[model samples]
Target: MPRYLFLKHYRTGQTPHPNAADRWTPQEISDHMAFMDAMIEDLKANGQFVGAEALSPRGTFVRYGGEGKPPVTDGPFAETKDLIAGWMAVDVESEEEAYAKAAYLSSAPGYGGRPLYEWIEVRPFLSEADTPDLG
Candidate 1:
C-alpha cells in the first residue's frame, strides 16, 4: 500500500470557510476536535491510519553552515505564505483512496457547526516502487 500525506494549511485567500479558530466558540472547537478524532478512529478501523500531528506556528529554518561553524538560523516563520497547520499520514492502496480520505478530513466542522471544506493537500510518499530499473 502506498502512503500519502494530507497537509492542512493556514491559507487566507480563497478560503471557503474563513472562520479563524481563535474566533470559534469553545464548543465549536471541541466539536471540531471530536470530529477529527472520529475520523482517525474510522481510518484506524480500516487499517489506513498511520500518524497525524498539529504543528506549532512558531518554527525556525536552520541550515548546516560549513563543516561546524555554528548552524545558521533564519526564522520563526509564523507569518510565512505557506504555513501548514497540521498533517495526517495514511497508508492506502491507491491515490484515489488517499484523495477520498483527504476530502473527508476537509469536511471537519468549523464555526457554526458548518463544514470547513478547506483544501487538503494530498502527496504520495515515494519508495522503491517508484524507482525505475537502471539495469
Candidate 2:
C-alpha cells in the first residue's frame, strides 16, 4: 500500500458553494465538524485511515541568517497566492481509493447542510524507484 497526501487549499478566486462563510450559523458549523469527526471514526474502524489534520490560516515565514542571528518575518507572508488550509494522509491500496476518499471529504457539509465541494489535491509519495534526483 502506498501513502497519499490530500491537500485542502484555502480561499482562492473560486466561489464557495454557498456565497460566504459568514452565512453559516453556529449550529451549522458544529454540524459540519460533527460530520467530519464521524467520517474519521468510520475510516478508523475500517482500518483505511492513516492520519488527518488542519492548519491555521495565519502563519509566519521565517528567514534565518546565522546561529546568532534571529529569524525575521515579513508581514506580507500572512497570505500568499496559495494557502494550504490543511491535509490528510492515507495509506491506500490504489489511486482509486485515494480519489474516493478525496471525493468524500469534498462532500462535507457546508452552509444550510449542503456540500462544500472543496477541491482536494491527491498526490502519491515517491517510491525509491520513482525519485531519481534524491540519490
Global Cα lDDT for candidate 2: 0.78
> How do the residues 76-128 of candidate 2 rate in per-residue lDDT, one tens digit apiece?
56554266777888888899999999999888887888888877889998887
lDDT of 1 by residue, 20-127 (tens): 676789999899999999999999999989999987766767789999598787754534436788999999999998998899899999888999898898999989
Best by TM-score: 1
* Model 1, position 65: C-alpha lDDT score: 90
Candidates in order have lDDT scores of 0.84, 0.78
Residue pairs of candidate 1 with colliding backbone atoms:
none
Query: Which residue pairs clash in candidate 2?
Result: none
